[model samples]
Target: MITSEVIWLTGASTGIGRSLAIKLASCGNTVIASARNQQALEQLAAEYNNIIPLAFDVTRQDSIELMQQQLSNYSGHLDRVIVNAGTCEYLDIDTPDWDMMRRVMTVNYFGAINTVAAAIPLLEASPRPHMIAIVSLATLAPFPRAEAYGSSKAAMQYFFDSLRIDLVSKNIDVTVINPGFVKTPLTDKNNFSMPFLMSSEQAAERMVKAIAARPRQFDFPRRLKWLLKVLGFIRALWNKIIAS
Candidate 1:
Protein backbone atom coordinates (compact mmCIF):
# COMPACT_ATOMS: atom_id res chain seq x y z
CA MET A 1 0.00 0.00 0.00
CA ILE A 2 1.21 3.47 -0.89
CA THR A 3 1.40 5.74 2.11
CA SER A 4 -0.20 9.16 1.94
CA GLU A 5 2.07 12.08 1.16
CA VAL A 6 1.89 15.67 -0.06
CA ILE A 7 2.14 15.54 -3.87
CA TRP A 8 2.18 18.43 -6.29
CA LEU A 9 0.79 17.62 -9.75
CA THR A 10 0.99 19.92 -12.76
CA GLY A 11 -1.44 20.01 -15.74
CA ALA A 12 -4.17 18.96 -13.37
CA SER A 13 -6.94 20.95 -15.00
CA THR A 14 -7.74 18.06 -17.30
CA GLY A 15 -6.80 14.74 -18.84
CA ILE A 16 -4.07 12.61 -17.30
CA GLY A 17 -3.07 15.08 -14.62
CA ARG A 18 -6.65 15.57 -13.54
CA SER A 19 -7.17 11.83 -13.42
CA LEU A 20 -4.02 11.44 -11.41
CA ALA A 21 -5.05 14.15 -8.95
CA ILE A 22 -8.35 12.39 -8.41
CA LYS A 23 -6.69 9.01 -7.91
CA LEU A 24 -4.05 10.32 -5.57
CA ALA A 25 -6.54 12.37 -3.57
CA SER A 26 -8.85 9.38 -3.32
CA CYS A 27 -6.03 7.41 -1.79
CA GLY A 28 -5.86 9.93 1.11
CA ASN A 29 -2.93 11.99 -0.11
CA THR A 30 -2.97 15.76 0.01
CA VAL A 31 -2.62 16.84 -3.63
CA ILE A 32 -1.65 20.30 -4.86
CA ALA A 33 -3.02 20.61 -8.40
CA SER A 34 -1.53 23.22 -10.72
CA ALA A 35 -2.81 24.34 -14.12
CA ARG A 36 -3.46 27.47 -16.20
CA ASN A 37 -7.20 27.23 -15.77
CA GLN A 38 -8.25 28.71 -12.46
CA GLN A 39 -11.98 28.14 -12.78
CA ALA A 40 -11.60 24.56 -13.89
CA LEU A 41 -9.16 23.89 -11.09
CA GLU A 42 -11.50 25.48 -8.58
CA GLN A 43 -14.27 23.22 -9.81
CA LEU A 44 -12.01 20.21 -9.40
CA ALA A 45 -10.95 21.30 -5.96
CA ALA A 46 -14.58 21.53 -4.95
CA GLU A 47 -14.79 17.78 -5.34
CA TYR A 48 -12.11 17.00 -2.76
CA ASN A 49 -10.88 18.76 0.34
CA ASN A 50 -7.34 17.47 -0.10
CA ILE A 51 -6.99 18.97 -3.59
CA ILE A 52 -5.65 22.53 -3.65
CA PRO A 53 -5.61 24.26 -7.03
CA LEU A 54 -2.70 26.49 -7.97
CA ALA A 55 -3.27 28.22 -11.29
CA PHE A 56 -0.23 29.17 -13.38
CA ASP A 57 1.23 28.70 -16.83
CA VAL A 58 4.04 26.16 -16.81
CA THR A 59 5.82 27.81 -19.76
CA ARG A 60 6.47 31.01 -17.83
CA GLN A 61 9.36 31.19 -15.37
CA ASP A 62 7.74 33.98 -13.37
CA SER A 63 4.62 31.89 -13.01
CA ILE A 64 6.69 28.95 -11.88
CA GLU A 65 8.14 31.01 -9.04
CA LEU A 66 4.69 32.18 -8.06
CA MET A 67 3.56 28.57 -8.03
CA GLN A 68 6.35 27.67 -5.67
CA GLN A 69 5.16 30.39 -3.32
CA GLN A 70 1.62 29.14 -3.51
CA LEU A 71 2.83 25.63 -2.80
CA SER A 72 4.48 26.78 0.41
CA ASN A 73 1.13 28.10 1.58
CA TYR A 74 -0.07 24.52 1.90
CA SER A 75 2.95 22.57 3.07
CA GLY A 76 6.54 23.33 3.97
CA HIS A 77 7.78 20.25 2.14
CA LEU A 78 6.59 18.35 -0.91
CA ASP A 79 6.91 14.58 -0.81
CA ARG A 80 6.38 14.16 -4.54
CA VAL A 81 6.09 16.31 -7.64
CA ILE A 82 4.58 15.04 -10.88
CA VAL A 83 5.62 17.35 -13.73
CA ASN A 84 2.91 16.22 -16.09
CA ALA A 85 2.49 19.55 -17.85
CA GLY A 86 3.63 19.62 -21.48
CA THR A 87 2.74 20.73 -25.01
CA CYS A 88 2.96 19.02 -28.40
CA GLU A 89 3.24 20.45 -31.88
CA TYR A 90 3.74 18.38 -35.02
CA LEU A 91 6.04 19.92 -37.60
CA ASP A 92 4.66 20.35 -41.08
CA ILE A 93 7.73 19.67 -43.16
CA ASP A 94 6.31 21.16 -46.35
CA THR A 95 5.34 24.56 -44.89
CA PRO A 96 6.44 24.18 -41.33
CA ASP A 97 5.80 26.75 -38.65
CA TRP A 98 9.36 26.74 -37.38
CA ASP A 99 8.30 28.82 -34.40
CA MET A 100 6.25 25.87 -33.17
CA MET A 101 9.47 24.11 -32.32
CA ARG A 102 10.43 26.84 -29.86
CA ARG A 103 6.94 26.89 -28.38
CA VAL A 104 6.93 23.13 -27.83
CA MET A 105 10.40 23.14 -26.33
CA THR A 106 9.59 26.06 -24.07
CA VAL A 107 6.75 24.09 -22.52
CA ASN A 108 7.86 20.48 -22.69
CA TYR A 109 11.56 20.94 -21.96
CA PHE A 110 12.40 24.30 -20.39
CA GLY A 111 9.14 24.44 -18.51
CA ALA A 112 9.89 21.11 -16.89
CA ILE A 113 13.34 22.34 -15.96
CA ASN A 114 11.84 25.35 -14.27
CA THR A 115 9.46 23.14 -12.35
CA VAL A 116 12.35 20.98 -11.22
CA ALA A 117 14.33 24.00 -10.09
CA ALA A 118 11.43 25.32 -8.06
CA ALA A 119 10.68 21.92 -6.52
CA ILE A 120 14.23 20.91 -5.61
CA PRO A 121 14.49 22.88 -2.39
CA LEU A 122 11.12 21.70 -1.15
CA LEU A 123 11.89 18.13 -2.18
CA GLU A 124 15.17 18.20 -0.26
CA ALA A 125 13.22 19.01 2.89
CA SER A 126 11.21 15.83 2.66
CA PRO A 127 12.35 12.49 4.07
CA ARG A 128 11.31 10.71 0.88
CA PRO A 129 11.16 12.95 -2.16
CA HIS A 130 10.09 11.51 -5.49
CA MET A 131 10.12 13.56 -8.69
CA ILE A 132 8.09 12.21 -11.58
CA ALA A 133 8.02 13.55 -15.11
CA ILE A 134 5.44 12.55 -17.71
CA VAL A 135 7.27 12.19 -21.00
CA SER A 136 6.16 10.39 -24.18
CA LEU A 137 6.80 7.04 -25.79
CA ALA A 138 7.10 8.90 -29.12
CA THR A 139 10.74 9.47 -28.23
CA LEU A 140 11.28 5.72 -28.54
CA ALA A 141 10.87 5.79 -32.35
CA PRO A 142 10.75 8.38 -35.08
CA PHE A 143 7.27 9.25 -36.28
CA PRO A 144 6.02 11.35 -39.19
CA ARG A 145 5.41 15.02 -38.33
CA ALA A 146 6.68 14.41 -34.78
CA GLU A 147 9.82 16.49 -35.14
CA ALA A 148 8.87 19.06 -32.55
CA TYR A 149 6.98 16.83 -30.12
CA GLY A 150 9.45 13.95 -30.24
CA SER A 151 12.50 16.15 -29.81
CA SER A 152 10.98 17.98 -26.86
CA LYS A 153 10.20 14.75 -25.03
CA ALA A 154 13.64 13.39 -25.84
CA ALA A 155 15.17 16.44 -24.20
CA MET A 156 12.96 16.05 -21.14
CA GLN A 157 13.85 12.35 -20.83
CA TYR A 158 17.56 13.16 -20.81
CA PHE A 159 17.20 15.99 -18.31
CA PHE A 160 15.36 13.82 -15.80
CA ASP A 161 17.70 10.86 -16.27
CA SER A 162 20.73 13.05 -15.60
CA LEU A 163 19.07 14.75 -12.65
CA ARG A 164 18.36 11.31 -11.21
CA ILE A 165 22.08 10.70 -10.83
CA ASP A 166 22.70 14.08 -9.17
CA LEU A 167 19.86 13.60 -6.69
CA VAL A 168 20.95 10.08 -5.68
CA SER A 169 23.02 11.18 -2.69
CA LYS A 170 20.24 13.48 -1.54
CA ASN A 171 17.94 10.45 -1.33
CA ILE A 172 15.50 12.02 -3.80
CA ASP A 173 13.99 9.57 -6.32
CA VAL A 174 13.42 10.62 -9.92
CA THR A 175 11.07 8.78 -12.24
CA VAL A 176 10.19 9.30 -15.89
CA ILE A 177 6.82 8.11 -17.18
CA ASN A 178 6.46 7.24 -20.87
CA PRO A 179 2.94 6.56 -22.01
CA GLY A 180 2.31 5.36 -25.57
CA PHE A 181 -0.95 7.22 -26.31
CA VAL A 182 -3.85 8.32 -24.20
CA LYS A 183 -7.25 9.74 -25.12
CA THR A 184 -7.06 13.24 -23.68
CA PRO A 185 -7.69 16.83 -24.74
CA LEU A 186 -4.09 16.96 -25.89
CA THR A 187 -4.21 13.81 -28.02
CA ASP A 188 -7.69 14.71 -29.28
CA LYS A 189 -5.97 17.32 -31.43
CA ASN A 190 -3.93 14.65 -33.24
CA ASN A 191 -5.01 14.04 -36.83
CA PHE A 192 -3.38 10.63 -37.14
CA SER A 193 -4.27 7.26 -35.71
CA MET A 194 -2.78 6.48 -32.26
CA PRO A 195 -2.24 2.77 -31.75
CA PHE A 196 -3.36 1.20 -28.47
CA LEU A 197 -4.73 4.46 -27.17
CA MET A 198 -5.89 4.18 -23.56
CA SER A 199 -8.21 6.41 -21.56
CA SER A 200 -6.82 9.11 -19.25
CA GLU A 201 -8.14 7.20 -16.23
CA GLN A 202 -6.41 4.01 -17.30
CA ALA A 203 -3.14 5.82 -17.81
CA ALA A 204 -3.47 7.57 -14.46
CA GLU A 205 -4.10 4.30 -12.64
CA ARG A 206 -0.98 2.77 -14.13
CA MET A 207 1.08 5.83 -13.29
CA VAL A 208 -0.12 5.87 -9.67
CA LYS A 209 0.82 2.22 -9.29
CA ALA A 210 4.24 2.88 -10.78
CA ILE A 211 4.80 5.80 -8.43
CA ALA A 212 4.14 3.57 -5.48
CA ALA A 213 6.80 1.18 -6.70
CA ARG A 214 9.18 4.12 -7.33
CA PRO A 215 11.19 2.81 -10.24
CA ARG A 216 13.75 4.77 -12.25
CA GLN A 217 11.39 4.69 -15.24
CA PHE A 218 8.04 3.29 -16.34
CA ASP A 219 6.48 2.86 -19.81
CA PHE A 220 2.89 1.87 -20.25
CA PRO A 221 1.07 -0.45 -22.67
CA ARG A 222 3.95 -2.92 -23.13
CA ARG A 223 2.89 -3.66 -26.71
CA LEU A 224 3.67 -0.12 -27.82
CA LYS A 225 7.05 -0.21 -26.13
CA TRP A 226 7.93 -3.42 -27.94
CA LEU A 227 6.64 -2.04 -31.25
CA LEU A 228 8.81 1.02 -30.90
CA LYS A 229 11.80 -1.14 -29.92
CA VAL A 230 11.31 -3.31 -33.01
CA LEU A 231 11.09 -0.28 -35.27
CA GLY A 232 14.18 1.23 -33.68
CA PHE A 233 16.09 -2.02 -34.24
CA ILE A 234 15.20 -2.00 -37.94
CA ARG A 235 15.51 1.67 -38.72
CA ALA A 236 16.16 1.09 -42.41
CA LEU A 237 12.97 -0.92 -42.80
CA TRP A 238 11.02 1.58 -40.73
CA ASN A 239 12.28 4.44 -42.90
CA LYS A 240 11.30 2.55 -46.05
CA ILE A 241 7.86 1.68 -44.68
CA ILE A 242 7.14 5.27 -43.66
CA ALA A 243 8.58 6.63 -46.87
CA SER A 244 6.52 4.19 -48.95
Candidate 2:
Protein backbone atom coordinates (compact mmCIF):
# COMPACT_ATOMS: atom_id res chain seq x y z
CA MET A 1 0.00 0.00 0.00
CA ILE A 2 1.22 3.49 -0.95
CA THR A 3 0.90 5.59 2.19
CA SER A 4 1.95 8.92 3.70
CA GLU A 5 2.98 10.38 0.35
CA VAL A 6 1.61 13.35 -1.52
CA ILE A 7 0.25 12.11 -4.85
CA TRP A 8 -0.90 14.45 -7.60
CA LEU A 9 -3.42 12.65 -9.78
CA THR A 10 -5.13 13.99 -12.88
CA GLY A 11 -8.51 12.82 -14.23
CA ALA A 12 -9.64 12.38 -10.65
CA SER A 13 -13.24 13.49 -11.20
CA THR A 14 -14.31 10.09 -12.52
CA GLY A 15 -13.56 6.47 -13.37
CA ILE A 16 -10.26 4.91 -12.34
CA GLY A 17 -8.86 8.24 -11.28
CA ARG A 18 -11.69 8.78 -8.80
CA SER A 19 -11.28 5.31 -7.33
CA LEU A 20 -7.52 5.81 -7.07
CA ALA A 21 -7.98 9.08 -5.21
CA ILE A 22 -10.25 7.44 -2.66
CA LYS A 23 -7.95 4.46 -2.19
CA LEU A 24 -4.79 6.53 -1.86
CA ALA A 25 -6.39 8.99 0.55
CA SER A 26 -7.77 6.21 2.69
CA CYS A 27 -4.23 4.92 3.14
CA GLY A 28 -3.23 8.21 4.84
CA ASN A 29 -1.79 9.79 1.72
CA THR A 30 -2.42 13.36 0.61
CA VAL A 31 -4.05 13.25 -2.83
CA ILE A 32 -4.24 16.29 -5.07
CA ALA A 33 -7.19 15.52 -7.35
CA SER A 34 -7.24 17.46 -10.61
CA ALA A 35 -9.87 17.64 -13.36
CA ARG A 36 -11.85 20.30 -15.21
CA ASN A 37 -15.02 19.42 -13.33
CA GLN A 38 -14.87 21.57 -10.24
CA GLN A 39 -18.22 20.43 -8.86
CA ALA A 40 -17.26 16.80 -9.15
CA LEU A 41 -13.87 17.37 -7.61
CA GLU A 42 -15.51 19.34 -4.81
CA GLN A 43 -17.91 16.50 -4.11
CA LEU A 44 -15.02 14.03 -4.01
CA ALA A 45 -13.06 16.32 -1.71
CA ALA A 46 -16.01 16.57 0.65
CA GLU A 47 -16.08 12.81 0.93
CA TYR A 48 -12.36 12.41 1.61
CA ASN A 49 -10.48 14.68 3.98
CA ASN A 50 -7.15 13.66 2.43
CA ILE A 51 -8.20 14.88 -1.02
CA ILE A 52 -7.64 18.41 -2.37
CA PRO A 53 -9.39 19.42 -5.56
CA LEU A 54 -7.43 21.39 -8.13
CA ALA A 55 -9.53 21.75 -11.24
CA PHE A 56 -7.44 22.19 -14.39
CA ASP A 57 -7.87 22.14 -18.18
CA VAL A 58 -4.87 20.70 -20.04
CA THR A 59 -5.62 22.42 -23.35
CA ARG A 60 -5.32 25.90 -21.91
CA GLN A 61 -2.51 28.18 -23.11
CA ASP A 62 0.69 27.85 -21.08
CA SER A 63 -0.89 25.00 -19.17
CA ILE A 64 2.39 23.63 -17.82
CA GLU A 65 3.44 26.86 -16.15
CA LEU A 66 -0.08 27.52 -14.96
CA MET A 67 -0.41 24.02 -13.54
CA GLN A 68 2.86 24.27 -11.68
CA GLN A 69 1.71 27.52 -10.11
CA GLN A 70 -1.65 26.08 -9.17
CA LEU A 71 -0.06 22.92 -7.75
CA SER A 72 2.30 24.86 -5.51
CA ASN A 73 -0.75 25.99 -3.59
CA TYR A 74 -1.33 22.40 -2.49
CA SER A 75 2.11 21.04 -1.63
CA GLY A 76 5.79 21.88 -1.98
CA HIS A 77 7.03 18.47 -3.08
CA LEU A 78 5.24 15.67 -4.86
CA ASP A 79 6.26 12.08 -4.21
CA ARG A 80 4.24 10.91 -7.19
CA VAL A 81 2.33 12.30 -10.15
CA ILE A 82 -0.27 10.18 -11.97
CA VAL A 83 -0.92 11.53 -15.46
CA ASN A 84 -4.33 9.97 -16.03
CA ALA A 85 -6.33 12.61 -17.84
CA GLY A 86 -7.44 11.23 -21.21
CA THR A 87 -10.17 11.35 -23.88
CA CYS A 88 -11.22 8.89 -26.56
CA GLU A 89 -13.11 8.97 -29.87
CA TYR A 90 -13.72 6.21 -32.38
CA LEU A 91 -13.33 7.09 -36.04
CA ASP A 92 -15.93 6.36 -38.68
CA ILE A 93 -14.10 4.51 -41.44
CA ASP A 94 -16.69 5.57 -44.01
CA THR A 95 -16.61 9.26 -43.06
CA PRO A 96 -14.02 9.88 -40.38
CA ASP A 97 -14.04 13.29 -38.72
CA TRP A 98 -10.38 14.20 -39.14
CA ASP A 99 -10.80 16.85 -36.47
CA MET A 100 -11.47 14.19 -33.84
CA MET A 101 -7.90 12.92 -34.23
CA ARG A 102 -6.58 16.33 -33.26
CA ARG A 103 -8.78 16.40 -30.16
CA VAL A 104 -7.54 13.04 -28.90
CA MET A 105 -3.89 13.83 -29.69
CA THR A 106 -4.17 17.17 -27.92
CA VAL A 107 -5.48 15.54 -24.75
CA ASN A 108 -3.56 12.26 -24.71
CA TYR A 109 -0.23 13.25 -26.24
CA PHE A 110 0.56 16.92 -25.70
CA GLY A 111 -1.48 17.02 -22.54
CA ALA A 112 0.74 14.33 -21.04
CA ILE A 113 3.84 16.26 -22.04
CA ASN A 114 2.48 19.40 -20.40
CA THR A 115 1.61 17.49 -17.25
CA VAL A 116 5.11 16.02 -16.93
CA ALA A 117 6.64 19.44 -17.52
CA ALA A 118 4.61 20.94 -14.69
CA ALA A 119 5.31 18.11 -12.24
CA ILE A 120 9.06 17.71 -12.77
CA PRO A 121 10.02 20.82 -10.83
CA LEU A 122 8.06 19.79 -7.77
CA LEU A 123 9.00 16.13 -8.13
CA GLU A 124 12.66 17.10 -8.06
CA ALA A 125 12.17 18.37 -4.55
CA SER A 126 11.10 15.00 -3.26
CA PRO A 127 13.63 12.43 -2.08
CA ARG A 128 11.80 9.66 -3.91
CA PRO A 129 9.90 11.12 -6.82
CA HIS A 130 8.05 8.95 -9.31
CA MET A 131 6.02 9.64 -12.45
CA ILE A 132 3.25 7.36 -13.67
CA ALA A 133 1.01 7.58 -16.73
CA ILE A 134 -1.96 5.49 -17.87
CA VAL A 135 -1.19 4.42 -21.38
CA SER A 136 -3.33 1.68 -23.03
CA LEU A 137 -3.01 -1.95 -24.08
CA ALA A 138 -4.08 -0.90 -27.58
CA THR A 139 -0.46 0.08 -28.18
CA LEU A 140 0.55 -3.58 -28.14
CA ALA A 141 -1.28 -4.12 -31.43
CA PRO A 142 -3.58 -2.13 -33.70
CA PHE A 143 -7.33 -2.10 -33.11
CA PRO A 144 -10.16 -1.07 -35.44
CA ARG A 145 -11.46 2.50 -34.97
CA ALA A 146 -8.68 3.21 -32.44
CA GLU A 147 -6.32 5.00 -34.78
CA ALA A 148 -6.31 8.25 -32.82
CA TYR A 149 -6.45 6.89 -29.27
CA GLY A 150 -3.94 4.13 -29.89
CA SER A 151 -1.51 6.41 -31.68
CA SER A 152 -1.69 8.94 -28.88
CA LYS A 153 -1.09 6.33 -26.17
CA ALA A 154 1.69 4.72 -28.23
CA ALA A 155 3.30 8.16 -28.34
CA MET A 156 2.96 8.37 -24.56
CA GLN A 157 4.58 4.97 -24.07
CA TYR A 158 7.55 6.13 -26.11
CA PHE A 159 7.65 9.49 -24.34
CA PHE A 160 7.70 7.91 -20.91
CA ASP A 161 10.35 5.35 -21.86
CA SER A 162 12.55 8.12 -23.22
CA LEU A 163 11.85 10.38 -20.25
CA ARG A 164 12.82 7.58 -17.90
CA ILE A 165 16.34 7.73 -19.33
CA ASP A 166 16.50 11.52 -19.01
CA LEU A 167 15.23 11.50 -15.42
CA VAL A 168 17.64 8.79 -14.32
CA SER A 169 20.31 11.28 -13.30
CA LYS A 170 17.68 13.17 -11.32
CA ASN A 171 16.75 10.04 -9.36
CA ILE A 172 13.13 10.05 -10.52
CA ASP A 173 11.49 6.87 -11.78
CA VAL A 174 8.83 6.59 -14.48
CA THR A 175 6.19 3.92 -14.71
CA VAL A 176 3.70 3.38 -17.53
CA ILE A 177 0.46 1.51 -16.88
CA ASN A 178 -1.30 -0.35 -19.69
CA PRO A 179 -4.71 -1.44 -18.57
CA GLY A 180 -6.76 -3.77 -20.82
CA PHE A 181 -10.25 -2.43 -20.13
CA VAL A 182 -12.06 -1.03 -17.13
CA LYS A 183 -15.78 -0.38 -16.66
CA THR A 184 -16.38 3.36 -16.63
CA PRO A 185 -18.95 5.87 -17.82
CA LEU A 186 -16.70 6.49 -20.81
CA THR A 187 -16.34 2.84 -21.77
CA ASP A 188 -20.08 2.32 -21.24
CA LYS A 189 -20.51 4.22 -24.50
CA ASN A 190 -18.47 1.66 -26.41
CA ASN A 191 -20.36 -0.34 -29.05
CA PHE A 192 -17.94 -3.26 -28.94
CA SER A 193 -17.48 -5.88 -26.24
CA MET A 194 -14.52 -5.39 -23.88
CA PRO A 195 -12.52 -8.44 -22.82
CA PHE A 196 -11.63 -8.93 -19.17
CA LEU A 197 -13.48 -5.74 -18.34
CA MET A 198 -12.40 -4.92 -14.79
CA SER A 199 -14.06 -2.42 -12.49
CA SER A 200 -12.43 0.93 -11.82
CA GLU A 201 -12.19 0.23 -8.09
CA GLN A 202 -10.43 -3.08 -8.72
CA ALA A 203 -8.06 -1.49 -11.18
CA ALA A 204 -7.30 1.29 -8.75
CA GLU A 205 -6.57 -1.14 -5.95
CA ARG A 206 -4.20 -3.17 -8.09
CA MET A 207 -2.42 -0.05 -9.41
CA VAL A 208 -1.71 1.33 -5.94
CA LYS A 209 -0.13 -1.94 -4.83
CA ALA A 210 1.74 -2.47 -8.10
CA ILE A 211 3.41 0.94 -8.31
CA ALA A 212 5.04 0.62 -4.93
CA ALA A 213 8.12 -1.01 -6.47
CA ARG A 214 8.17 1.62 -9.24
CA PRO A 215 8.75 -0.78 -12.13
CA ARG A 216 9.52 0.64 -15.57
CA GLN A 217 6.19 -0.58 -17.05
CA PHE A 218 3.21 -2.65 -15.94
CA ASP A 219 0.24 -4.22 -17.79
CA PHE A 220 -2.86 -5.95 -16.38
CA PRO A 221 -4.80 -8.12 -15.82
CA ARG A 222 -2.60 -11.12 -16.67
CA ARG A 223 -5.26 -12.73 -18.88
CA LEU A 224 -5.72 -9.66 -21.07
CA LYS A 225 -1.99 -9.21 -21.50
CA TRP A 226 -1.70 -12.85 -22.46
CA LEU A 227 -4.52 -12.52 -24.95
CA LEU A 228 -3.04 -9.42 -26.57
CA LYS A 229 0.31 -11.16 -26.88
CA VAL A 230 -1.25 -14.24 -28.42
CA LEU A 231 -3.23 -12.06 -30.81
CA GLY A 232 -0.11 -10.17 -31.82
CA PHE A 233 1.74 -13.41 -32.55
CA ILE A 234 -1.06 -14.41 -34.93
CA ARG A 235 -1.53 -11.01 -36.52
CA ALA A 236 -2.15 -12.41 -39.99
CA LEU A 237 -5.07 -14.55 -38.81
CA TRP A 238 -6.29 -11.81 -36.45
CA ASN A 239 -6.20 -9.20 -39.22
CA LYS A 240 -8.28 -11.41 -41.50
CA ILE A 241 -10.84 -11.91 -38.72
CA ILE A 242 -10.89 -8.25 -37.62
CA ALA A 243 -11.13 -6.88 -41.17
CA SER A 244 -14.90 -7.13 -41.09
Tens digit per residue, CA lDDT, model 1, 1-244? 4457999988899999999999999999999998889999999999999999888687888766777787888999999999999877788788989999999999889989888988888898999999999998888889888898899999999999999999999999999999999999989998777899999999999999999999999998999999888998899998887666
Candidate 2 to native Cα RMSD, angstroms: 1.0
Q: How would you encode candidate 2's per-residue C-alpha lDDT over 87-140 as one tens digit per residue? A: 999999999899999999999998888888889999999999999999998888
TM-score of 1: 0.97
Q: For this target, which candidate reaches the highest TM-score against the unseen true structure?
A: 2
Each prediction's RMSD to truth = 1.1, 1.0
lDDT of 2 at 164: 96
Name the 10 consecutive residues with the lowest summed lDDT in model 1.
62-71
Question: Candidate 1's C-alpha lDDT?
Answer: 0.91
lDDT of each: 0.91, 0.92
TM-score attained by model 2: 0.98
Report lDDT (Cα) of residue 48, candidate 1.
98
